[model samples]
Target: MTGTTWDILLLGGASGIGKSRAAARLAAGTDGFIVEFDDVVSAVQAITTAEHHPALHHFDHAPDTARLTNDQVLALQIATAQALEPAVLGVVRNRLTVDTPALIEGDYLTPAAAARAVDDGQAAGRRVRAAFLHEDEPEQIAANYATREPDDGDQTERADVSARYSHWLAQQARTYALPVVPCRPWDTLPARIREAVD
Candidate 1:
């Protein structure tokens, strides 16, 4: 496994866009693990509770509780990236050592980060592939939000943020040449990922 490894599959997308589901299926079918980026951030936030500050809203009319400033979000994102590094590296190393594969599920990896990972993986004798998920319609994503019922704290405003994130992700994927997988529904995503992985 240390010789040359398969691509490090990264599934990134808007919340509730089936990135996790696709990653789960990939992991189930291959030798991989699921690393949820949001979970990593939450864990860091809990540990650094002392440093945690109220997030400022982006919109002027946004609810007082709903605003999260760019600086605040960037801080959280950096912390999350730091926390995820060791974990991600561990997975990559383990897979390489044992000649296995890893399917990492997260949204924190910006296109630049993805490219960096690709370079690092290649240097370490492993390939890296990125997949960005996209939802065809906002209505479907809203329905998914209703079904998931994510926690009230970070994801309470998911319905609105998801659209923004999805659009941003799509643009990033196009700009970075990352593969974009359009997910129509939960049932269809696993098969698509399977095809990609296979």
Candidate 2:
């Protein structure tokens, strides 16, 4: 990711752990575009209704995340990722023809699913790779969340959900043989991710 070119890069992780920051670095390094999966999700939600795609719109109508259990939130995230995984693969595969490369990144891009798609691309003779970011400290994540959204007083709860999700995401990444890089000391995160993925 640091020195070499790629057809596509899939970056996934728990919320507020700097997946976007890492993607920006990779995209800048590679002179590629950054594709935010949140935008993809928004686009999907626009064309589809909850009746057809409930997971994609599960949180749309529900403004209060505090009412939902951590497990429920995680389940919804996973479900939405599963639903979008195939399209993600397709976009990566099709975009291979273009001269410009891209980093498709967001929480919606599950590590295991993205890794599987990368593997599929490789098996079919394509150049694609994936890496996940993780934050081991829930407190740090909470601080990051709070800093990112000062008005959101529920950062502690968000941090709890993100921490649990990060742990589960790391487990899945390991099980699928994908690199899970710890995001901290901000300056060294890019190097660590490059080392792990390279």
- Quote each prediction's TM-score: 0.68, 0.89
lDDT of each: 0.60, 0.79
Steric overlap count per candidate: 4, 0
lDDT, model 1, position 171:
82
Regions of model 1 farther than 4 Å from truth: 1-7, 49-63, 67-100, 150-157, 194-198
lDDT of 2: 0.79
lDDT of 1 by residue, 40-133 (tens): 5466455643334323112222345336754444344444443455545554455555545666677665555565566667787777766778
Residue-level lDDT for 50 in candidate 1: 39
Best by TM-score: 2
Task: For candidate 2, write residues 57-132 as lDDT tens digits.
Answer: 7776567866888888777777777788766777776667676767788887777568777877787676788888
